[model samples]
Target: MPNYTLLTRQLEALLDDRDWLINAAQTCAFIMQQVPELNWAGFYLQRQPELLTLGPFQGKPACNPIPFSKGVCGGAARSRQTQRIDDVHAIADHIACDAASNSELVVPILRQGTLWGVLDLDSPRHGRFDEVDQAGIEALVEVFNARTDLPDFLSSH
Candidate 1:
């Protein structure tokens, strides 16, 4: 596994840029490269009431706009909490962006105790993400939450 602290620092540095969208895209790409076995690593931004629009992502084309009540990402956004599924097939509303994706992890980014969006990742192997990954990613989202300059891409919702 990549050093989560190192990864966090790298992400922080990259996000320091003034262009928030570019920062988000670069962060997604960097994490995709640093982490192993991940099929997707990206953001699903809250676009409107009860909706999540796909933002920066590194993977096959995803469901462009996912309703907040739909898949694992939607569930996390709806509940405003981190969600991890060992087997995507077992989840009732799993959205198969890629048929090969067997596991998923989502961490909601909260600002002022409200759901902002989610950091979502998918893996080809079942049980690929565990508590450690959940914690690390959750911490990463918190880092983003602390930033005051996060772009309005999803904030406009």
Candidate 2:
């Protein structure tokens, strides 16, 4: 099992010094390196209303921009919640940036109870992410929310 506590602590420290984009990218890369069975890990930012622009990511080059209601990343952003899909092929509106991706997890980054962006991860193995992974990633997002400065849309009252 991944030590989420330690991971969260590391993420908090990382975010304290780095800018959001670089911190997000490095954090995703760190998770991808530490975790097994993962094929892709990165972020999708809400650059505009109903649109998520690709952010720092580790893995194959992904689609540049994804709609807020489309893929797993989009669904999470739209719902402002974490989503864990055991099989991407079974999901409607699944965007196959990489056909090899079988499972996916997306955790929304919220600030002051507003959606900002998402932390996304993809795996080649079916059912690669579960409740434990969800909790871990959620913890990471919490660390992000607490440590990083929120974007104007998320921070504004």
Top-TM-score structure, candidate number? 1
Which residue pairs in model 2 clash with each other? none
Clashes per candidate, residues 3 or more apart or on different chains: 0, 0
Q: What is candidate 1's lDDT per residue for 42-135, written digit by digit as tens?
A: 9988767788988889999998789987989989998887889999999888898899999999988776666667889999999998888888
User: What stretches of model 2 exceed 4 Å from their correct place?
Assistant: 153-157
Candidate 1 accuracy as TM-score: 0.91
lDDT of 2 at 38: 90
Q: Residues 1-157, candidate 2, lDDT per residue (tens digit)?
A: 7888888887777776436766777788778877788999898877677888888889999996898879888899888878899999999999999999999999988766666788889999999998988998888877766666556553343
The residue-level lDDT of candidate 2 at 106 comes to 91
For model 1, what is the error of residue 14's alpha carbon versus the real structure, in angstroms, after optimal superposition?
2.2
